[model samples]
Target chain A: MLKFDEQKVKENMEGALKLRPQINEVVDQIHERGFSNICWLGIGGTYASAMQAVVHMKEKTALETFYENAAVFLTTGNKRVTKDTLVVISSVTGSTEEVVDAVKKCNEIGATVFGFIDKAEAELATLVDHLISYPLNEQLKFFMVADRFMYLAGEFDEYDEFYNEMDQHFAQGIVEVEKAADKFGQEFALKHHQDEIHYFVGAGNQWGATYSYAMCYWEEQHWIKTKSIESHEFFHGMFEIVERDTPVTIYVTEDSQRALSERVVNFIPQICGNYTVIDAKDYDMPGISTKFRGALSPFIIHAVNNRIDVHIEKINCHPMEIRRYYRQLDY
Target chain B: MLKFDEQKVKENMEGALKLRPQINEVVDQIHERGFSNICWLGIGGTYASAMQAVVHMKEKTALETFYENAAVFLTTGNKRVTKDTLVVISSVTGSTEEVVDAVKKCNEIGATVFGFIDKAEAELATLVDHLISYPLNEQLKFFMVADRFMYLAGEFDEYDEFYNEMDQHFAQGIVEVEKAADKFGQEFALKHHQDEIHYFVGAGNQWGATYSYAMCYWEEQHWIKTKSIESHEFFHGMFEIVERDTPVTIYVTEDSQRALSERVVNFIPQICGNYTVIDAKDYDMPGISTKFRGALSPFIIHAVNNRIDVHIEKINCHPMEIRRYYRQLDY
Candidate 1:
């Protein structure tokens, strides 16, 4: 039985909101550090958030900041700290081997390490020079607060009131997430009535949303035929595979990809050749809480991903089970 | 209506082979230009090859290089040219807008421009201070020649009889491609069984191979449900959606990702619910044209993709004519 405390989701969302300014303060320090490249390292859900953050950094600075293992600290270790490379490591447990390995690797080689974790005094914290902890909730999967906060630290400038604003957003966000679950939950459970396949797509900041969809579809429900690509690249080649009457969902965003969001919705029938779009933009998300910008949109979108897992699992007529385990990259 | 010159593939292949060393010899020369950052500008296939090249350069020297486009050049045109940043611009149709735009961007910024083209007196030639041209048979798409030379560039050390060896590679490569077309062409054409969706995945060097497969699944066969993702990221949350029997083709390498490759081939069956693999290690793709390292592995695999496309279209019976007159990005 999964124990998802509604209060916990509310609290974490609020925490992400409450801690937004603290994250910004950290970002101020990083910008001052003047590193040319920033690599965010993490595992599992945290790893996913790290990847999304790395992409956000690359787009903002045109610098080659990517997700890597802490082990890279051992190899590409910088002899002297310059404004060239900075590494941000995150781990929910803070004890995942790769994360631990990366932490030690950062230690062996004199590379700068900034960490995010729920457990401030965790083993990883002991290894890193600077560490920050996210507001922890009872639910194990509540690090979205920390992720959004850390990402804000690396990006925006006027987050003076971000913490207060984010808390408000998360309090309201829980209601929106429940509404999404209540609205789509049953329809998602009707696999027997529908065709034999399913697809989920997230556009722009909604990549995090689609990621949650995959978690639901493949992890809890055990559906294997789902995928999400950055919406801009979709038109280049993947459009031909959409079939007549196939179930497809697209996440909307107010980011640079808003136009792409609109395009997919309009062109679905024309381009997919036959599939229909199940819209989700009407489901309001808690974007304001973390002072989450429209551009960094995927963060707030992650909440609904949990319900989607149930939707897929209940429909599959199978026990809630993880049919496939994925490769978690390590340092 | 399509004019594919038969020999153009061969000529370009040889020309690509010739251009490799020139690119290698001059890469060091441009590195001496005193720029701290490197930016490569290219379009279409040239851009695709550049993606592969930059990864190789980064792996080999640990130097930081960037990829820029003309449209966003002014915004991303920030790297200092003081021996730390290097600019490499490439195009098959040397007149492509992006290439010309990059030339202007590089020149205005006082960055050294290294231009590679097929035509000697091409428009790109006029824009660049340092230009290199290979007499590739322009009658073909940059597909064949780009594959040939890019592969060679990744493989051989210039001083090691690279050209003669690759000359033989092209000859053997042609045979390998034709043979693949023969085996998979019929299966590619078997589109009547439309119950399944296809997801193509490639990692590291073979990343570009799936691009060719995209054309095969979408353009050639008109299968609109096909999608491609890099194999490394394929594991994480993405692996969860491997439907009860979704078709997944893994493109992997023997050297770098050997461990991951073996693990995925084993993992897919359980998680994907249904699966298949085209293993690079088990499959023989001509002789190891020592000069055609990992990136160009796509060219040989493309023969398989090309065969699939031509074969799928052979089923001319389905009259939906799924091809839309105009392509749009999203729904």
Candidate 2:
């Protein structure tokens, strides 16, 4: 619990929940205007976030959704992004060069682009057709958008019930998740913070969280070397590198592909002495239904990972915000 | 080329070329039967190969193509795949558990499944609707399928010309590529064979090759720890972790996203003194058009990388085919 801000975490979750009405209003406008397909565009962490939503849509809905890396999209435009495409994008800084350029390209293509920006005065806020300034809970905002679209499309019958449950329990449930994870996260950091390299494995929608946490948090924030591989992919080639003492972390979700990670969990411990399993099922979500757990696994895993990051920063005596090259020197 | 057999490589390349007529015949039947969409399924290296083809299809053709990891496809079925879906798969052993299972699942869904197997008696060959017994050049076969489909759909007008040029030049062109790359590859392996972790960066179509080489060749074959990142993604988070002497290799391709990798190539030298650029443009493909270079960059890069693998295997004194777990242990 070192350096953990309980009050701030609560406020951020509640604040994001409060954006439901605005999110619904924006989604309503999108529904009214109509779109042929949905395109989620982002870069790095945001790209990983969008990928989680796209994976969910692919599983439960018939909606045509495309997840693209903002930089790649900016450079080599997707043929699917026609005037009728609905482009959904997000940027924490609202000034990520690639995302901003991609948003402009989307507009030039006559696509209806809506974006979530952290600052109303940011360049991207001004560029997008519909801009929602929400500073926290990016994954939550993305789910709201995806769920609302599915609801309107008659693909999600539990839409109202799910959100109602979320309204009543999500903030408290997530706080409990963080509290539950704090001790383990601290212990994990204490044990493996100095490891030369870490291998992260996860499956289903949680794959995005696995990927982002390794790149955005471990490597970027802590300046650690890491490799993030999907659970199934881990067996393909990466498994050969695992020794008895190699440090590995596998995330187990309640999603349909849970068995994939379970396979890794089952296989790794037999070969690797240093391995950790961060299972979403271990954290209680209070009143949330089991049916929705898979859909919400990314949020749960990310909240748990945030605790790990905090402890890693504290343990390593390295401020999470410190960067040597990013925005520091000309590339 | 410490362990490379130039004559063997020539035979393999020419053998793959000779299969072009059979590849076209299979593709013709697929065209005649007609499919609403294309699904390329594989695991590990094959999955990476399929991704390169999908990226190409996305750029040039209006075809609805889905690239999926075989395990994930088996566990969580994609809604886009149906009876009219054309499932293209590959397996070297023809007994990859997840791939065999995925092909069965595809069959159950009544989809038309065709596969490339190294042996005619392989399990996957028996299961698929159309079986192609090809022992080498998996990427070339994939390209043939993609290009032929595009040609039939009228999206690629120069397909015949491209293949004609390839028929005339591909085998010799690739041999020359390997010869050109031998010294550099050997030097790279000798210089960095002891490095704890190597970072690989590539963009566009070459991204798949980058990912596969790091996992399949470095990790699986040599038991080396490495991280493979896309060129654009490197700037986002991974760049922050790069030190002055980090061993970073950037694969610069002739594709549209070449600038993305070029940016990495240009920036890395400024920060990191130990860096390598394996640019596809540097390799010559006799009689092949400039327009075809981008599409064929993966092949050129792979041929270049094969030399690197040979030298790594030689310097490390670890046979590339040796594995502690893969098919050797009950994991």
Candidate 3:
């Protein structure tokens, strides 16, 4: 409510929903054509978002999926990306150099390229074999592209049903997340505004959200120190850094890996001095089925985390959009 | 060598060399028997080490390879892991619970498992189908496991020749790395000893070393904050965090992707106030071929970084081995 636009959030969600027909048509055509494997490519937030699709594919489907950073993909070409490979890439700004280069390489390799470009007239839109032009909202665009590929992989027979459920439930979820963010996010930011280091943990699909929120929203936006590790990997080595006052944020998805995060949720309070658990299970998705909630948690969590982004900026008096070096100076 | 034992380094290098006959026999069997894919499983450092093998596979061979966190693997159960899948795991203590669980699961799936166990009497030694017992040195163990996978994937026609070369050149490389680390590493620690945050950048095979050093050594061992990002991904979002005095360490591997890391080497110094470049090329890896240097750089870099670890501990007056929570208190 402070810096977040509720109307913009709803419009972004609806825009993704509106692409359901096109997503279905494109997926059907790809399925009919037949592909060997699926490849997801992007950079930064987009790459983190594609990682969620990879986790979803691992959990729900038997499809061979490869998720890679767009820049790295160019240097270390995936051997699996042959003529039969399907490459799905999303670039909020169609001019991301690495994504454009990757798409060009995919074309050279004769792989089927599906591009999700925010701008209709962007470079990636022209480079890709199939372009899905939409308004750029990194979070929503991720869902649109990932959902399309997931459906094409034949994991969900009720793809249309799920899309309808999203249409009915996403607006309500946003309002609920906004409320939670204003209450909890504001309180947490006020309490820990001076804290320089934070740790974020998540498992399954929500792991990507956990990582993106820390890197894109927290570290890049605010220039804070953050480490985003998977929930299961938390106990491995990172758990050593748990001082009493160290802030920890756990994004628990309501998936098969729920127990994994729950383990940390129960343990952190006892060992960590400060901890915040954003359990997607706590969110009430009005019309969404329990079965689908786990799969849809990433999108819901994105909306929820969006509020924290607003609150941290509000409390710190920092412009969330300002960067010290990124695009400000060419490297 | 403040903390490093030169004798131990040579012994560890030789121990890895000693495993070659067994590694070769097992890999030859797997190659002749024919497996569908390769699965590299470990937790934390071991998982990070496994990642280098995955990168090597991507760069050199067309093998369908999967590198996963052992804990996450137990929960997610890769659809790729079948009777035809070859699961490679390394457990130094041979008692990592999640890794043992994963090995059991892989066994249940009838997948061929190769275990690199530090202790001959460890639990994983009993669980795996094939076991290579040696003293636990993360660097050498990584080389041993990764080389086996690389050979099994049919990347090398002269696997024995490579191993013999390693046997001949590894000791000299270790000694050379020790000298560089003492000189370069000590200077770095003295200058940036108070720095709390560090950014590690690497490309190609050295990317795994960059990550392992940041997470496993710095964060886990020293309880410091670190962001280990691939060189290509640095420009994506993480670069925004670069301030005038931000500490950035670049690991420049002498591989085809050397240019990738070089781009960051040239860029970071201009924007970031302080930076350290640990180019593997700077170390004289005598008798090792230039074409092979990139693939072997992880090992060379590991030895070189070990000196930095020693100096960081000495300067900070902190025992790197002490853990606040890891294995100290049970969760």
TM-score, per-candidate, Cα-based = 0.72, 0.97, 0.95
User: In candidate 3, residue A73 scores what lDDT?
Assistant: 80
Candidate 1, TM-score of its B chain: 0.72
lDDT of 1 at B240: 61
lDDT per residue as tens, model 3, B124-171: 798899888777665565556556767666676666677677889877
**What overall lDDT goes with each candidate model?**
0.52, 0.87, 0.79
- In lDDT terms, which candidate is top? 2
Give the per-residue lDDT of model 2 (tens digit) for B1-331.
Answer: 4666889888888888888789889888888978888988988999998888888786677677869888888777787888999999878888899999999999898999988899889767889998888687888888889989989999899988998898888998999998998888888889988888899999898888899999999999989888999999998898888888889999999988999999898888778888988999999988998988998889898988888888888888889888889987775
Ranking by lDDT: 2, 3, 1
> DockQ ranking from best to worst?
2, 3, 1
Identify the CAPRI category of the predicted complex in candidate 1.
acceptable
DockQ score for model 2: 0.76
Residue-wise C-alpha lDDT for candidate 3, range A1-331, written one tens digit per residue: 5766777767776777777678667777888888898888888888887888787777767778878888778887788889998888887778888888888999999999887887888767888888788775555555555666667666667777887787888766766767765677778777766777788889988887787788887778877777788887788777776778888988888877888898898888778768988888777878888878877677667767767777778778899878877777676
Question: Against the true structure, candidate 1 has what lDDT?
Answer: 0.52
lDDT of 1 by residue, A1-331 (tens): 2335777667666665455456556655666665555666654455556655643443344345555533322333332223355667766567766578766765655566777677877777788766677854312222332343344455335434554454556466655666556545555555422444455665544554465455434542465555554454445345455555656666766554566556667777654544434344445655453234553345434445555455655665555554434333221
Distance from true location, Cα of B75 in model 1, Å: 11
**CA displacement after TM-score superposition, residue A312 of candidate 3 (Å):** 2.6
